[model samples]
Target: MSEAPSASPHTPLPAAVPPLTAPSVPPHASSALLASLAPLLHEWLPRQRWFAGKGRPVDRFTLVSATELMPLTGSPGLLHLLVRAHQPQTAPPSGSRGAPPPADCYQLLLGVRRSLPTSLASSLIGQVQDGPLSGHSVYEAMEDPRLATLLLERLRVPGPLGSLRFEKEPKADVQTGLAPRVLGLEQSNSSLVYGDTFILKIFRRLHPGANPDLELPLALAQEGCARVPEPVAWFEGANPDDPYEPYTLGLLQPFLREAQDGWQLALRHLADGRDFTDEAHALGRATAEVHTALAAALPTLSLGRPQTELLADQMTDRLDTAVQAVPALLPYAPGLRRAFDALRRLSSAGPAVSAQRVHGDLHLGQALRNGDGEWSVIDFEGEPAKSITERRRPQPVVRDVAGMLRSFDYAARTNQPWNPEWAQRCRAAYCEGYAAVSGTDPRTMPELLRAYETDKAVYEVLYEARHRPDWLAVPMAAVQRLATT
Candidate 1:
């Protein structure tokens, strides 16, 4: 309700002493309410695009933390939460002691009211039959402009809203009360565009420690990389119960209104049977620039025999897993292993390469081409299927190149006639441009590049089989080529 203290630094609050008001956290009317919403959430969460643990059944819902942004006593109330979803252990990740860890913690923003309008029907979670507000209705808060605008204001002020911490960049001059609307994009996260000024990405799946999306962009911006948008403000879960634990919930950045989506642009070119060599070359140069900046800003390692062999082993393991899930990949498994074996052979020959923080999941969809024909990469969050720690790991630059190459193939296949020649041309041009800028050609390291591409294709096979069955043939086509040649 008041401006932040003048004495407070513009930088993010340290893990130590933090200044703020007493937030309306659990002591308020929310615990009973959370208990009431558990059943509703279990039903609704699985249907959403962003929910990570899809096929797994939710065992229970644990209220990790709750913050009443706007109490239900007011107009339309806003409740912020970090709830952990417990699910059956399938093939769980490493590092587990006594019991299995929680499936995932989600950052949910819900709008509470006594009635839901016809327009907000799509946003509905369900009417709460029991809670603090016994007869109240609830829906996604971000879909409501009033609640979304209120969120921006909280970030603008930069202070404590209970266990939730809203922070603004020191140099960022954020405006108050900008009109907000949801950005309609197929992503694992929800985004709100505020009057073409900024876009706020609310992470539906919450994780401890800094998210790579926020961390990588900040690192690149510091390196004076113009290929990524600078983060303006962000909010995190400031757990009063455990102040030491960190959780990045959302990120806000300046919106690029005039930039054309790279995926859409590629699809349009494919549909028209146009040559995309020039654009592909320029995009490759842009990718090189981002990679260069990331190397300059962060840590880099010399990956030798040990690393390469380990990488090859990892690829083989992933391929085995994929074959188990998608039986169509069974026949190609032996052929795919050749790529990994080649990488191992190269490693045995004493070929060493550089490893650094990469784009992790670079594709046509993750890039944007401005009106001036300049390329800007977006979403540094890495692969959606990976954990935060995995996303933060350094990998070979060719891994990113491999992803974009796969994307070119996807674009060509998605178009009616499946133009492999166009994809081949674009791939070559992209590598040429990259070599020109980075002083290293990924094509020169054919074995390593092929290994990464095969690894990615294997991942795609499993993902498509689980998520989009109709798109199974797309990656299977690539599998056929990679398996044989």
Candidate 2:
């Protein structure tokens, strides 16, 4: 491990954005229609976990295009919209204006149709009812059930939909046993389990390029890494000319049905007072092997000497932001600074290992313990909110180790009602395993662990602050412990 860099100054900032407001998409038909439908979409978007702009203000709305997928009566019509929302532009204090206002945009696949005129337009837009839009009317409309069905049908099609076509292969017709069952967990992507054998993850937000989950894992698997779920196939259009076009909609992969998620498994072992040293050791060895394999499979990148210095720099930057956001972190500033300094010193004490491709997000949730007693990894999506460029960057293998270590802490803390020492035992076991396989020195483990732990904890603090403030204690506690230690 290399030495970490110095801590930067803290700067307080305001919230990223103001409270979310209802969007206004001018109806292509009439103002009356717009008034009736805008609020409906607004209410629906927030209710969906897959809506990326949830809780953010919709500065403006523009409907780029709309398409109807089915009939409105006996058959359902799926309404898909290319919508964009504007956000306040963040600029530096200088004279030059900053980049354009941040735009939140995505394709909204809805089920809709013309509703009959009643005493008045119902306050609800996509609500499901026993009858039509009105008690006496013959027409009815909905978004969820209709759209979901259309998505399912399209997925069931032998090849891609619309201009997004797939190459015909002899095995293309081979039964993948994919019976799409919707998963309740997601914020911006719709997930369905196909025939209990594979999962089709439909990305709600459109982007160009191949899906990372599809691309990276296949590479890793080809490199003989067995940790990730095998990529069975991907859904994307062959055409490249369409912009604002939704392509590469989903991916199909073997589902690890019999295995317990690593997080839950760790918690169970901790609660039962079952020693996790062996398990952690296994995980560590597996992780090292993964790193070795990744290095061999992907191109190696170089970063200057004393890797510890680089580690220290990353830690300092994260800590600086954390201290500013949560003033409670100020007291630990000196200790954090000292830790980085120590890390920097240690970097020069050893030879630099070549940087390799690594799992950008490696946590307990990313792995499963199969019935056969082997660990399998999943979700190569790599931080859904980050850009493709950032996700593809090369980094130290220790960064992944740090993520796993933090995950152990998370598992322990989350299951504290069952066992408090879960994190400690698991951490020890995992480190021991990693050391055994990587031939890493025991004496050097502390600083490396500390730097990585601190880095991960700091990330968690920010993550929790933005996404789930209620869970802030997990990372905050870790930060306090690291600072004190």
Candidate 3:
């Protein structure tokens, strides 16, 4: 693995734009081929769960690169293409009626192809269309499973194309060909765990900027930050204009083989009727250590009122959308408004805290409790749907702390089947931990916590409404609690 980039706080930053290339073939491929493949892509993509935009049309298709797997037994001259598709940008038609404009961008589609297998015709037929393709599909040859095996083998092989550079050599023996298990945790990206020892995250959305998860953790690991997975190799290319642009398409990292996630651990403690004070205190100290290390390694950037104002505006917009999506939430709009107003007031308080770089998305799921009972964080990728520009911006550290706190609340509520008193105990433990390391007076900390928590709750309301309507109650309940307290 290559040495991680230097940790100097003042290093010049790279531009966020991704390299672009013109289509080799005409932008639109023949409808015959696309129609044949659309249904396969659509069905397969949604099933994979790693596909970011489930149920949405894959608007554009570009085959950036392909590597063929072995031939099928019964079929001659047939090959499988491990194809990558580029998402296109388009606008909704102007002056359209109540119908919202069409999606502005195409979705990234991964294509798998082979001669049609005989027995699976029913599963594969009729998914194709006439004009533009309606969905994405995969064509597999029946005579041989070699193509599928080969694809899996290639993913497991740590060749130059798949290998990532790590700051420290792995303590565990690094072996290839672990059975790949697709994790069901993510929405926008596909994550495959290899042999329960390493994780390979393939991004579905193509963006030009360095993935913060790929870059930030690597930087922190290089600086001896032990609270996150150690940096490993990232899959990137040198050519910016090639169909395969120079971006972190995938990342390879060590997996916490025996560790439970922090959220689960907290819930476990709560279930056992154990006080979370110690764990909370440890978390606080660990978080403080991470912040201190981050401050040392990266330059502190200015965060002005404009940024806060923008955040407030985003919260407002999300609330409006949420109310429209779930009219049930309408009755709670007054409480939601109060929360938004509080956020705006805090924003207008005028730069009480300096903006420094922060974990774009910090929550319990992003952390793991290792076998040794230590906590390690992962996934620095910001909100997956946001633009790279937004993900890369500097923000207050309290935002991250707020995320962690919200996660504790989520763990408690979601795991109620296991522990009834989980939420209250976990919150107490986490707050105690945060207070110890933050060194802020209790009075001021409450203000910061309230502001951050309210901000996070508003985001949660929208996120849950769109993706997990069942969980919308989690954020709504938090809003009610916040308003009362």
Give the Cα lDDT of each candidate. Answer: 0.85, 0.61, 0.57
Per-prediction TM-score: 0.92, 0.75, 0.71
Candidate 2: list runs displaced more than 4 Å.
1-38, 63-74, 79-82, 89-102, 113-160, 163-179, 237-248, 305-314, 342-353, 417-421, 435-448, 465-470
RMSD for all candidates, in order, please.
6.0, 12.8, 10.2
Q: Which residue segments of model 1 deviate by more than 4 Å?
A: 1-22, 27-30, 91-99, 239-245
Ranking by TM-score: 1, 2, 3
| CA shift of 11, model 2, Å | 58
Best by lDDT: 1
Expressed as tens digits, the lDDT of each residue in 120-139 for candidate 3 is 34334333343333332234
* Candidate 1: tens digits of C-alpha lDDT, residues 1-485: 22222111122322322234536555555568678998789899888889988789998887877777776675467888888888888755455367665468888999887777666778989988876767777899988776787777777878877777889889899886467889986558999998789999998887677889999999999999999999999988864455676788889999999999999999999888799999999999999999999999999988889888998998998898788778999899899999999999998785587899998999999999999999999999887667888898889999999999999999999999889999999999999999999999999989989999999999988989988999999999999999999
lDDT of 2 at 115: 40
Residue runs of model 3 more than 4 Å from their true location after superposition: 1-39, 55-60, 67-186, 237-245, 346-351, 415-422, 441-443
